[model samples]
Target: MDWERFARQMATMAHDLLEQDSVVGTLERIVRSATELVHGCDAAGILLMDGGRVRTLAATEPMVDASDRLQERLQEGPCFDAARLRDGERVYRIENMTVLQQRWPAYAPSARELGIGSMMGFLLFTENENLGALNLYSRLPGRFTETSETAAWVLASHAAVALSSARSHAQMTESVATRHVIGEAMGILMAGHHIAEDTAFNMLRRHSQDRNVKLREVAREVVELGALPRPEQPSRQ
Candidate 1:
C-alpha cells in the first residue's frame, strides 16, 4: 500500500463528503465513489432501511437497483444484514455469490443470475443509529482483496459521518420551518379568538390529539386555512 497516497486520498474523500449539502447528494456520491475508488467494485449502491422496507438512495447501475429491490423483497442478503448489523459486526462480505446460495437463499440465486459474482456491504451508522449499508458489487468471483476491503471500510466510515451530518442538518431545517408555521398559526388564533399564547397553543394541541394527527400537521392546516379543523363531537345518548 502507498501509505502517503492513501492518506491524501482519504483526506480528499472526507472533504468532498462533508461538503455535500443534502443527504441524497451525499449518498449518491458514496456509491459513485465506491465504484470509482474501491478496487474490483464494478457497481455500487446505498441501501437505506426504514424498519423492514429498503430503499436505494443511489446506485451506479440499474443492476444494483434491481439487486437491492430483490434483497428488500426477500428480506435476506448481505446488504440487509449489514444494515441491521448484529453486535460487533459492521461489515459483510460475500466473496462468491454463486456459492452462497444457502446463506441468502432467495437473493443469491437471483443475484448470481443477474451476473453479480461478489458483494461487500458496510453498515452506515452513528454511535446511536444504524442508518443503512454501503454496498459494492463485482462481476468476478473473489475480486475483492484485503486492501480493497480496508480502503472501502475507510470510505464507509467517512460516509457514515457525512450521512449523519446531512440528516441532522435536514432535520434542523425542517424543525425551524415547522416552528415558523406553528408561530404563524398561533398568531392567527390569538388575533381571531383574543386568546393568550398558552391558550392558543393548548387549542392546537387539543385539536392535534382529537384528530389523531401530528402537531406539525395541525399547525400546517391552521397556517394554510387560517382556521383550526374541529371535528364534530358525538352527543351523549
Candidate 2:
C-alpha cells in the first residue's frame, strides 16, 4: 500500500466524519473505512468495555461479529488480552490454538471454528484512559505478518482518536441538554412557588440528595409533572 495515498484518504475520511456532526454515524464510517485499509484481513471490529463487560461497538463483517461474540462469551481472546495488557503491550497472535487452549481453552476452539485462524489485536487508549481494543481476523493460518501488525497498530491509533472524539461529543451534547432541562424546571419551580431562584435550586438539590436520584431527573419530574410530594408534617408527640 502507498503510505502517502493511504494517509491522504484517511485524512479525508476524518474530515468527512467531523463534518457529519453525529457520533454514531461517524463511528460507523470509521470502522468500515478502517477495515478497507488493513489488507488481507477478512473483517474488522471495535470492542468497548462498558459496565465491566466488552461489547461490540462496530463491525465490518459477519466474521467480525462472530469473533467478537466468541470473546464476549468466553471472556478470553486476543482482543480481551490486548485490552487488559499494560500500555504499549501487544498480543499479536494465538499460535496453535490447540496448544494455547490451556490458557483460554473455551475461547480458542470457538474462535478457530468460526474460520478465524489468525488474529491481531491492539489496545485502544487515550492518555490515561483504556477504551478497549480493535481486532482484525483472517481465515488463513498465520495470516498476520509483521507488516500487518504494524498496519493494525496505525489503524488502532486512528480509531482511538475517533472513538474518543465521538464519545466526548456525545457526552457534551447530553450534558448541555440536561442543563437546559434543569434550567427550565428551575424556572417552573420559581414561578409556581413564588420562591427565590436559590431557594428553588436548594429544594431540588435536597430532594435529589434525599432520594439518591440525579438532579436532572428531579428537575425533569418537576417540569413534566408540575410538583413533587412535600415531606409530610409530623404530629406533636
Candidate 3:
C-alpha cells in the first residue's frame, strides 16, 4: 500500500462525508468509500439493528445485501455482532470465510456461497451513540490484511462523526421547517377564530393528540384547510 497516497485519499473522503446533503447521502458515501479505499474490498454496506431486525443501508452490490440477509436469518455474523455491540469489540474481521467453521459456523459457509471470501466489520460509533456497522466484503479468500483493517478503522472513525453531523443538521432543518409551518397554522387560526395565540396552539395540540397524529401534520392541516377540523366523535352502536 502507498501509505502517503492512502492518507491523502482518506482525508478527501472525510471532507466528502461532511459535505453530504443528508443522512442517506452520507451513508452512501461511506460505503462507496470503503470499496474505493479499502484494499481487496469488492463490496460494502452498513447494517443497522432496528428493533432486533436488520436494516441494510447503502449496499454497493447485491452481494452485500445478500450477506446481510443471511446473517439476519441465521442470527449471527461478524457484522451482526458489531452492530449489536456484542463481545465488547468494535471491529471484527473474517480473514477466510470459506474455511471458518467456527465463530459463526452457520453464517460462514452461506457467506462464502454468496461470493464473500473475507469480510470486515467496523462499529460506527461516537462517544454519545452507536450509529451502525460498516461492513466490507471481498471475493477472494485471505484478501484482507492487517493493513486493510487499519485503513478501515480510520475510515469508520471518520464515518461515524460524519454520519452524526449529517443527522443533526437534517434534524435541525426539519425542526425549523416544522416550526414555520406550525406558526403559520397558528396565525391562520388566530385570525379566523379571533382567538389568542396560545388558544390556537392548544387547539392544534388537542387535535394532534385526539387523532393520534403528529403535531406537525395537524398544524399542516390547519394551514391547508384554513381552519381546524372537528374532532372525531364516538359513533353509537
Q: What lDDT would candidate 1 get against the real structure? A: 0.87
Instruction: Please provide, for model 1 over 102-133, each residue's C-alpha lDDT reduced to its tens digit, 9 standing for 90 to 100.
Output: 67778888899889999998988734443588
- Runs with alpha carbons beyond 4 Å of true place in candidate 3: 126-131, 233-237
Candidates' RMSD to native? 2.9, 3.8, 1.8
Task: Show where candidate 1 strays beyond 4 Å.
Answer: 100-102, 126-131, 230-237
Count of backbone clashes for each model?
0, 0, 0
Output the worst ten-in-a-row residue range by lDDT, candidate 2.
91-100
Q: Top model by lDDT, which number?
A: 3
lDDT per residue for candidate 2 within 130-189, as digits (tens), equals 457777877766667777777767777776677778778889999999999888888888
Q: lDDT: which is higher, 1 or 2?
A: 1
TM-score ranking, high to low: 3, 1, 2
Give the worst 10-residue stretch by lDDT in candidate 1.
Answer: 124-133
Task: Kindly list the per-residue Cα lDDT of model 3 for residues 1-237, writing each as its tens digit.
Answer: 899999999999999999899899999999999999999999999988764588887899999999888888999999988987888999988999768567899999988889889999988853344448999999998999999999999899889889889989999999999999999999999999899999999989988988999999999888888999777788999
Query: lDDT, candidate 3, residue 6?
Result: 94
Q: What is the TM-score of each candidate against the true structure?
A: 0.88, 0.84, 0.94
**CA lDDT of each candidate?**
0.87, 0.74, 0.89
